[model samples]
Target: MIIRSALTRSLIPEFLTGAGRNQREIASALSSSRREFLRNTAGLVLGSTLSGASPFLRGESVRKKRKVIVVTFGGGARDQETFAPEGQENIPHLLNELVPQSSFFTHVSNQGILGHYVATASLTTGVYETLNNFSAVAPEHPTVFEYFRKDLKRPASDAWVVAPSNGFNRIGESECRSYGPGTGATVILPKHLLAAATSGGAADFDHLLRDNYENPLYTPQLGGGEFELQQLDGILRLSVADFMAHARTLSSPDELSIYIAKRLMQQEAPSLLWITMHDIDVAHSGAYSLYIEGIRRTDRLCTELWNAVQANPEYAGNTTLFILPDFGRDSDYDAGGNGFQHHRTGDVASRTTWMMALGAGVREGVIFNDPMQSIDLVPSLGAIMGFSPAQSQGKPIKDLL
Candidate 1:
């Protein structure tokens, strides 16, 4: 049976009455609550924030050895289950380990479609891409992977995306003429990889292969150039038997994705790596307990990924790690919604999210309450990696660069 969380725990119940107010107003209030929560619990300092300036004036040598790993919560969890006091118990690692050594952004909003694919696509392209969320089409603009590789002259293996679902297969590249197919990142779909590796005996590993939480029947046709089963053995050096054997020990798809991603780090050490975590999105099933479990798992997995970066020679002391949700869940403020179970309503609780940046030049224990949009990510990445996002509309988050 699906257990439901109390309304008061989701968002400030009093604030729900102001649902008709301007969106910016609600977003500001949401940010303020998170700002205060972090200030009191995480003990983060409210210091420098986003300046929107390019990194042209900064030292260029720093970009040469820099490695970036992005962890995006594609199935956004609300504050009640994450950063708030009621939710703090679910994210002990984030509060105790990660947040203390990071620059946290309290007010990151997603002003695009609430669908995970489109919102994440908008983040990758930094253009608020209008492509259908459920469609197999690529982003209309150049992806950050393209900008990084085309401008920095990096090889295909130097940029990679370990996505959670098969629908994200095209996210590695875009249709832009300036930077087409060959210049983008190499996409790795962990579920698809597992499916291919265990074609006939899928039932035993069904728990690890659950795709698209919201639409279970809608598996979009995966594109070409994805990480193949043959490449898994040749590149990751894990035989099908070994991969399947180890996968049987895992609990969720996110764990499998991290397993593949960590293998990529050890084997390839991609300069630009992106990992999309969607296990938290299982809330669509209306199980509050499962949603919270996903949050706890994500919290621990995040620490695991960061620890891997520190332990690896290529990423140690030179990598910058970013963790943020692609968007957030709905609250009682949206009448058309089911609260924490879905993001159908693009209300403040659904659109407003947060981010944390750690390692390399990041300011330790700093918190920024300034408002920023999801689209700002690509341009910020371009600025950090010494690339020009010619078509990206969002500005570079200077605080991070």
Candidate 2:
């Protein structure tokens, strides 16, 4: 399924050919008016691994057919509580179990909005989107998922975004006129889905707390077409009982995401998956102990995710894993903002994070000390998966390519 350079331009769909060519031509020549432009491109819905025996461990030529999983240490974590010398104790699994086996980047900067929704949008799109940080809106540009799906002609199940934040419901898609929902990722927000399933009176304080963190929006139900039903039946059938069990575990959002991730990889072996964890944002409570506990929990969940990848034969030896924080927190004593309480100060601590890449096609035991932008992840992923994200502003990470 890897559409390498050998796939000639003539074979690519008109919507996916050339660098930004599709969007530009459609925007300019297709319609004379704005409303007409949208109507004209309405049909262009971006309509959008694993396993196997021991062929990979046997060093067979299965490298070209790799899958990718991106685990974001989201909700803005600082190095002080996760990766620095003093913070090592809080993430023993990462430092002791995962770091040594991966290629680590010491300095990754996010030079854009520090809010969770906006920051993650920037990360996913490789563009610094300036949208309202708290709104339930999609990015203005096409996501990496859109690029991969449109080019590969993969099913919607092949690209996914497993998030806990309701504000990110649209993160799987975009508002871009050319490539929209038709080619967006299949988004799953665990907490929101659970809330939607739970009866109002039966919901407890824990459920209420989650609801407050991310209020689920209700839309009128619309019957799905035959194609939609066929494509989504399996995911829609996820058991409420199983979801509740995981929701009660340590770091509800993070753990639940990992649990669902395991199931997704097992059932579909998606070509691209993005998982975002948010417990660490509890630091905003300004409680040092709680923040550290969140860090420790995040560390554990990360290890669990890595373990899932290794244990799932569909993903085991032929998957690449990228883990990094969306952004950082203010320095402890900075006059701008208190430590671990704010990421809006634009301080080095708030903007600088780290990245780790492991598994297939990743160089082991290597450390990249040079500074790199956070947006670089999108294109680097493109290079690995064999497609160019036509609208991405960031260049691929040369080392990874």
Candidate 3:
């Protein structure tokens, strides 16, 4: 199914180019309700234009393979809370700092399942994935990780996924018939490791036995933690004391993930690393203050992640960073739900999101008024890293390619 709606393509450019009246004026004209109008227009445009059709190669040759980092603004966020003119106060670092150096896509559409795990699976695979959102199962198609590592013959240490979503343990690999686990990305669920380390959790021992003892009659259901640990037997793990000593001052699963990510950068510095931030999903609690706090904190964490990249010699001059929310939230006045509680509305607001691409091989300060899909990320990443996933249905982003 096509993920981008025609309204997304037709109106966002008009909003940015001032072809119509000002954004608020145009939004007013589109929907009688201000809330519904802002929801549709917020992520679509910011006026800055693409330099030309061949922007990527205006004055240079194809760039060398570069380090790539994709940060999924994994829970839902909305224009009222993020990129809208009034909403700009919440994301100072992004607007004041990163937007100036990044090629920002004001409108990004996610046309598939809105659940976090499945949406992320679609993002990494570039295919519309049909999978149980709450289940710990992997996608049915090959992921960018498999394509990059298998084709480049990169070592296991060269591709990584660090996430806090316990349900996302299987995101590192896919159940594709070919090029499967042998080339899956190395994944680190920081919270699980920390819990394992601190509690002497037998989750690990149980998973180890489960994988070895499986048979048709005796097979049992496993959660993401167990499912992930079973596949990661060879990776060295830290002792409770060791992890505590290393992270005595850190708290929250989000901070722990960031800590491990920086540590990974300091040591192995993988060529491709995708970090999923889940704190923003706290909105499920229905607390507006906590929800806003999550957005503010995510902004800070993203800045920290980018700063880590700039400081690391391995990632420093040659790395590219891509950031986007997995999807957006329902409108406050929408009939289905209220106040960012869920992403099931199927409204224009829920499927519409934004993206930012910065660092090496990106056009600085260009806010393209293009409406693109979440699946487009994989091919754009492939362009930078030098290999295309055989099953990706989306095309490479035009401006980036």
Candidate 4:
């Protein structure tokens, strides 16, 4: 249903009929596969059924109290393990509950480093940041947090991030001129908090304390700007003993993150909240069963977060929730890649992914296959929330606005 330009339409058939598969051909084929799978399995309507953009988009008065929650897939997941016929059984919540209420985009591509930290940094900044994936350096461009805070004249408490690693400490802010410290979101590392709360008695909690599944040899220094141990009592209103006692009941780090995010909603209720789920990154351990387990756990945790949004009066009716992966894992077709183990191959499968947007100001049960990039997220958010991403290399998507 994509209306290609005359020249592009003519060129596509030649590439499709060509002997070797090009990047565009691979991406288009993957998108078409996902589109057909969701349509048949989830009973979603094609976006072509809609007339134009969504009608729920309102004015600044309504947007003043609007909330946005972004959940990212830190580890790569492939179609065969997620949306395909063989993998559909693993994500029952997304297929049966969420996708029917979401505007699904099947052709989102990431044109940046495939590492979790750097890729997520690009997602926040709307720029392809080249900083070391394992380092503690901040992004070179301004983040969406800074724009949302500075332009909207909101305070630090209004924007917050709950990420999975020490590498994300600087992700809440950027070192860009005129938009640096104090003008961004405050990051909360749940594993780091648990480590401090247990105070060297964390041997029983090593499974929940796993950090940066991609690399265990390098631990970055704890940067000072993030949420610290002392503030846990003052901010989240939970004492160290109670927090650790609750942590004893959780199975994964993403669950702990969800627990913290729910408290944040009930306590501070920030207007902008970003949570990165890293459990799926356990694939780097080369255990296929564990990787599948991570996916199922993430699926349940995502629904829990959405339910929390609906249960809270401050966020229930006005919040827009977006769920997508930072990128995808390698394909079994690639000879150089080990299927689903790691994202180091950076193949076409690794670059192509999907996104779902649902809630206020969004169309439901429609699938759009229009090609987009990970960087476009910031501009789309800016347009919806009434801010300007001055240096972003992407444009706002009109379908949501």
Best by TM-score: 4
Q: lDDT by residue for model 3 over 185-282, one digit each (tens)? A: 87777756655554544443332111111011322233432224333233434445655665566535567678778877887788899998877777
Clash pairs (backbone) in predicted model 2: 45-182, 46-182, 46-183, 47-182, 47-183, 50-314, 51-313, 51-314
Instruction: Report the number of backbone clashes for model 1.
Output: 0
Write the residue-wise lDDT of candidate 4 on 28-91 in tens digits.
8878878877787777888876896465666878889999999996586888778766677778
Candidate 2 — worst ten consecutive residues by lDDT sum?
42-51
The full ranking of all candidates by lDDT, starting with the best, is: 4, 1, 3, 2
Q: For model 4, how many clashes? A: 0
lDDT of 3 at 272: 91
**Model 2 whole-model lDDT (C-alpha atoms):** 0.66
Residue pairs in collision within model 3: 43-106
* Clashes per candidate (backbone, < 3 Å): 0, 8, 1, 0
Q: What is the number of residue pairs that collide in model 3?
A: 1
What TM-score, computed on C-alpha atoms, does each candidate reach?
0.94, 0.78, 0.79, 0.94
How much lDDT does each candidate structure score?
Answer: 0.86, 0.66, 0.69, 0.87
Model 4 segments beyond 4 Å from truth? 1-19
Between the candidate structures 2 and 4, which one is better when assessed by lDDT? Answer: 4
- Model 2 ranges with Cα > 4 A deviation: 1-64, 201-233, 249-251
Candidate no. 4 TM-score: 0.94
Q: How does candidate 3 score on lDDT?
A: 0.69
